[model samples]
Target: MSRSTCVPTSEPALVVAVDGPSGSGKSSVSRAVARRFGLRYLDTGAMYRALTWWCLEQGVDLTDPAAVVDAMDAMPLEMGTDPAAPSVRVGSVDVGQAIRQTRVSEQVSAVATNLQVRARMRDLQRRLIHEASEGIVAEGRDITTVVAPDADVRVLLTATELTRLQRRALELHGHAEESAVAATRDQVVRRDRDDSTVSQFVTAADGVRTIDSSSMTFEQVVDALTELVGSRTGRVPRAGSA
Candidate 1:
């Protein structure tokens, strides 16, 4: 594994980067890890969803990279850390509910695929991490590879396609019909392809751990990650220090 960029400390905050495909349990695992250590948690995917909602509202062309970049720069983003009820804000407006709509979900990947948009978002992500005095557990597709490659602990979660699909379906429930689920599946597959083709998607690092969650309960995954963090730090994480 590549040398970790994480600086050691006597009472250091745990910086965890959790990466995985959609419905692979990144959110749940990341939240649990943060709660276990009392660290703040970030759902990076919400950033993209917020951006997508803004672009649609402004009628920006998703296919136009330059336009999307302009919108990204102009939009204001506010992220919250309350695990029980996290939120995202754009400008003076709160679009938390709007960003999760079926329309936004369908279009977010297109906007996310824009290289310039990703660059801008990456900058924002880095800023959030740097500003965190107490450490953070950030979960997203690119965190382990691009956003926080040098994080003290990098974990990649994976599960079978059927398991992922079922989990996603349950999340959608009445909001998405069969066609929407199919479209989401297609979008996920394409995103996977794009991420794999992107040179920076996965960093070759010695300490990066990959876990298959097909048969593991959420608690089991959390316990495993807790051990990884404990081994690296040589001590149990301090309360609220994840």
Candidate 2:
């Protein structure tokens, strides 16, 4: 938690790559860290979800990898990088919220697990990262390994299974009651299990920092990442500011 003495007076290009399992708060924490450092944010998972939503809309068979790849090639997707209000748009339709639907959650893993789909996404993600003006915080299952292995900072944020289930249940159902948690099992557990087939997110790879956030509040996790970023990049803010 100590600040670097060589902290730079002004911000520099810094790409922070974070990967984690479902409900591990990767997206939210990454966004918070990006906002703290005046950086862009990228939710790589949203790309997959957007693709899934598009595939479903186009009636592309999820089980057919070739068909899904065709759909992926034809899909027109746009991603907004602002951490404060990031968005996903497919063609003229805004799917920022639609991609988070239960139906999409249930099938996104199918598309994500496709090797061709992952390859295409990796290329696109790398392009976005390279084009980020001020730098970016990109989070997803394989970001730390595949998408941005050379990111300035890499973190694997994770939590206990019970905690992950409760958190996801709260997000999806507005409550973490037993019933809600039970209902969310498939979305958190099953989706993660399926997606893991293509990405290694359950554990941190070499040189990546591991942050077990089950006991940390959202603000605490954000602070931890922000501090890590400052330490790694020496791009610290003035004392007492951000």
Alpha carbon lDDT of each predicted model:
0.78, 0.92
lDDT of 1 at 26: 86
lDDT of 1: 0.78
Residue-level lDDT tens digits of model 2 in 1-242: 99768856744578999999999999999988888877899999999999999999999999999999999999999999999899999999999999999899999999999999999999999999989978999999999999999999999999999999999999989999999999999899998888888899998999999999999999899889989998998876435434
Show where candidate 2 strays beyond 4 Å: 1-12, 238-242
What's the TM for model 2?
A: 0.93
For candidate 1, the 10 contiguous residues with the lowest summed lDDT are 197-206
> TM-score, each model?
0.85, 0.93
lDDT tens digits by residue: candidate 1, 1-242:
78869867656565788888877888888888787777788998899989889999999999998998998888988998665566799978878788878888778887778888888888989888777767888988888878988898898887877667666766776434666567568556665666555423333345568887889988898888888888877657556543
Candidate 2 residue 41 Cα shift, in angstroms, is 0.4
